[model samples]
Target: MIQRRQGGFTLIEVLIALLVLAIGLLGMASLSMTSLQSNQGAYLRGQASMLAYDYVERMRGNSAQALLATSPYVISLTSGSTRNNPDCRTKTVGCSASELANQDIFDWWGNLQAAIPGSGVTVTKANTNEYQVVISWTESDAQQHSTGSQTQNFTLRVNL
Candidate 1:
């Protein structure tokens, strides 16, 4: 009589191993996706901040014609600001609004649609001829597991 040797892994053992592996793989996948998304958000936010600061720099070096304009809300880009992309003709001051608008920074911001896509900038003129350049964009903080946004500002108080 040949005896049957019961030397094999039970069904329960196989199932349990599979379950643990699946859970581990799922956790790793989720972590990878989250990391990718965070990187993208950070990149966008950085670009937005640089754009805002670029505007502030332009304003600091602004020409008297644009700065001293009667209009409190100086939005030259709305007008024929990009009509002329003249050379850096300013000897000791900023370029005219027209020239400034033709700069790369304005071009990067797309159009005067009144808002930056996936972001927003508020160029507020404050006391003592100061300018508050605020840039905002959405991002997720993994530690908090919260979905929200943030605002970064580059304050430039003109020497008036």
Candidate 2:
């Protein structure tokens, strides 16, 4: 008597194949998520860097105020609630150096908040004509598994 051979994969073979495919799919998904998070972190860092550079340039423009020890250029991370006089955005003819600095800080802080939530900026005087711009932001998702803290800081030092 001749026995007919099975023409398809066995149940065990099918199950093994499915398990392998599932693992591959899961790995792809995990890689995609990690790539997305990394991209977002990079984007945030770029924004922070640009903001710091922009502020530094503004300080350079107002070198007189920037060099002053009591100038707004030497500021801590505050809520930036000071209303700018003469509305620097519209009238740039007679705004004082301090007013321009205030306007710059206000606009920069606003942009920082809008671009990255929970972001803060601190400008510190390092020397007579040198300053450091420290930009801090929370990377809650990217650094969730890290040790210490989830906050990231970017510092840019400039000289007027």
Consecutive 10-residue window with the lowest summed lDDT within model 1: 71-80
TM-scores, in order shown? 0.60, 0.85
True lDDT of residue 7, candidate 2:
84
Measured by lDDT, the strongest candidate is 2
Rate residue 133 of model 1 by lDDT. 57
lDDT of 2 by residue, 1-160 (tens): 9999878988999999999999999989878877888898899999999888888888888888888878787877744434444477678476778887888777777788888777777888878988888988877464454433377899998778
Q: How accurate is candidate 1 locally (lDDT)?
A: 0.53
Candidate 2: residue 47 lDDT (0-100) = 94
Model 1 C-alpha lDDT per residue in residues 14-102, reported as the tens digit of each score: 99999999999999988997798778766765665566655655555554423553423233232223333344444367665655544
Model 2's alpha-carbon lDDT is: 0.80
Reference-based lDDT, each prediction: 0.53, 0.80
